[model samples]
Target: MAGATPLRVLIGKVGLDGHDRGVKLIARALRDAGIEVIYTGLHQTPEQIVASAIQEDVRAIGLSIHSAAHKTLFPRVLELLKAQGAEDIVVFGGGIIPDEDIPILHAQGVRRIFTPGTPMQEIVDFVKGLGQ
Candidate 1:
């Protein structure tokens, strides 16, 4: 396993959501856990996010949504991934998402949703499990 590549992930903030403190924290946590993280900063479109994921060759994409755009944005990313033949990249998110929206998001192919107060270790473990 010495030559094995570490799990790489793309941490993105899509739309006009300017609140990136949480995303930055998660990025740091993932890095601390030894996962490679490509922080895409804020104000990314679904196109930009998917392009980055493909370009970076990441195994997963983590979106930080606070602008109530998950319904629209998450699916667009998924669609783009499929269109680009990158559908195997797992998509997950965390932020101000309501409980009622979780099921809808999952149905749209979002692998998981972590709301406020979810532990950082939980996120780290979830990403780590993706390789298995």
Candidate 2:
């Protein structure tokens, strides 16, 4: 999120995903691209992430879950966002997610999904494009 409104973005790690190099790279890239990023380091429950997102008033949420819990973690995030009345917020994720599960993720309101080898510009542009 950028421009005059400066859509806030919450970059979070859900489940037990400890590998965060990719998360840091995306966060840094967003910051460099002039998007304000709120990085939630590691080991975040979906509830906590959503609560913070509502409190911070972010326009989009980018989750970086590398663990196998994407199946479980993804829906909970959507549920909570719906509960918080922020369902309009754009949600997406990146990590070691399987292609089969991606449609399910999107169906649950995940706007984008980037895998390990996906280009960095894609992530930045996708997130930035939300404002458009």
Candidate 3:
């Protein structure tokens, strides 16, 4: 474990969702838990997020989408990652997604979907567990 690299995660906001307070808080929590975080900021396209995740060599990608575009955007990220041969990078998401779409997103290769009011510790633990 002496030479182990710290876990890295890319937290991003894709689409026109300008509200970033939640993603920022999650980023801070992940960093405080010792995970290196790359936040791509707001209004990023799925292409930009996947490219950044691959470039940053992150273990996972956490996307926050509140624009009701989860059905399209989430899978696009997965598709892009697969296209780039980076499918090993775990993909998860959170935000104003509806309950019925949760299973759909999972089926589309999103590892997890955290809704609003989910405990921050659970997110931290999930991301940390990715390195295991």
Query: What would the TM-scores of all predictions be?
Result: 0.97, 0.94, 0.97
The alpha-carbon deviation from the true structure for residue 72 of candidate 3, after best TM-score superposition, in angstroms, is: 0.5
Q: What is the clash count for each candidate, in the order shown?
A: 0, 0, 0
User: lDDT, candidate 2, residue 90?
Assistant: 83
Runs in model 1 with CA error above 4 Å? 1-3
Q: Could you give candidate 2's per-residue lDDT for residues 24-113 as a string of tens digits?
A: 999999999888899998999998999888888888999998777888898999998888788987889889998999998988778888
lDDT tens digits by residue: candidate 3, 1-132:
233898999999999989898999999999999999999999999999998998999999999999999999999999999999999999998999999999999999999999999999999999988988
What value does the lDDT take at residue 59 in candidate 1? Answer: 93
Error of 2 at 7 (Å): 2.5
TM-score of 2: 0.94
| Candidate achieving the largest lDDT | 1
User: Which residue ranges in model 2 land beyond 4 Å of their true spot?
Assistant: 1-3
Q: Given candidate 2, what's the lDDT at residue 54? A: 88
Evaluate residue 124 in candidate 1 and report its C-alpha lDDT on the 0 to 100 scale.
97
